[model samples]
Target: MGPVLRTEHLVSADQQTGEIASKIDAALTQLARARQIQRQCLATRHGLSPLQLDILMTVAAGEPPEPSISLLARELGVSQPTVTAAVITLERKGLVRREPLPPRRTLVRLEPSGQPALADRPFVDAASRLDPALQEAMLEGALVMIAHLVDNGTLSVARTCLTCRFHRSDGGHYCVLLDLPLARSDLRVDCPEHQPAA
Candidate 1:
């Protein structure tokens, strides 16, 4: 049985609320499209394909599964051949190198020359100008959306507090690993300590 709500005022069938939700969805889509276009621009500027730029950025983020072709394929949601082909292009450009690891795995390593592609993130630059309060609120909401995507299997991975094993919502927001209560502003989107919840 579904739990009861304290009031029916916010139900989705309400015209105003439904319209607001639709607007929010459209805004999010535009935001994503804008970011993708910006990345494509940046890719062209640096003479790299968007896929190569993504591979470099993934390596720079340093969160694991450590950038093997198969790992990158899964991480970037592309096929192994596609990642291999892109990696070849990146390698020829001196942006990355292939290293042999044990158990017959090939590790893709970003080189110093690859740094330029990972630099100049337009969204990060723009978001940095937001006021602290707005930044925190945006981050909190983004984590919630990311968590929802992960739950829906739209995203294979997220290293955010919402998907972490240590997040406790039984009482107030808390981090068991940190042993601290979280204010909305204290919520983290990509914590180094993040461990996925089972």
Candidate 2:
């Protein structure tokens, strides 16, 4: 060989691994502390548990102005009983109401008292702090992630066929919301940015 290669030319693998580990540890610690703060804030500000706040937010973001317990359970990745317990607590606090839908299904929605909590200043402040472009990018990324999760069976669609505005429950199959015919393939469609009429 013309010249001996030096081991010093190569970077230390251990150093690279240590850097990555440090980053990961920092991320986990931050997440844990944030979650603790979130819990405490909910308890102190709204007098509600974190799960109850989650349930309220889920209903507020749902398609039909309200969501069933099954929908909440699916969205939260929890058992029906867990959702039921949260709903019961929310109801006791007058934060949510369970209304009887036509037929037998029950719809859960935020009570008047809960609307202010749902529109909490902290969430608004955080959203306002984000750049519009960054917010849009984040929403798009979330949608992509949700699609991937559903495709991989890690997430489940929860809204009922009839409750969906795009679903044609009557004899004809058309979406009143879209003002077009409905396709069978679009049954489980959902959008986080969907807004209802004023």
Every model's TM-score: 0.84, 0.56
**lDDT of candidate 1 at residue 74, scale 0 to 100:** 89
Q: Report the lDDT tens digits of candidate 1 across residue range 1-198.
A: 897777755555578777986987899999999989988999999998899889988887876767799988988889999999999999999989999999889989889999867778678888899998999888887888898899999888787899999999864579999999999888877688989998
Off by over 4 Å in 1: 1-13, 170-172
Against the reference, the lDDT scores of all candidates come to 0.87, 0.66
Clashing pairs in 2: none
Residue 75 C-alpha lDDT in model 2? 71
Ten-residue stretch with the least lDDT total in model 2? 189-198
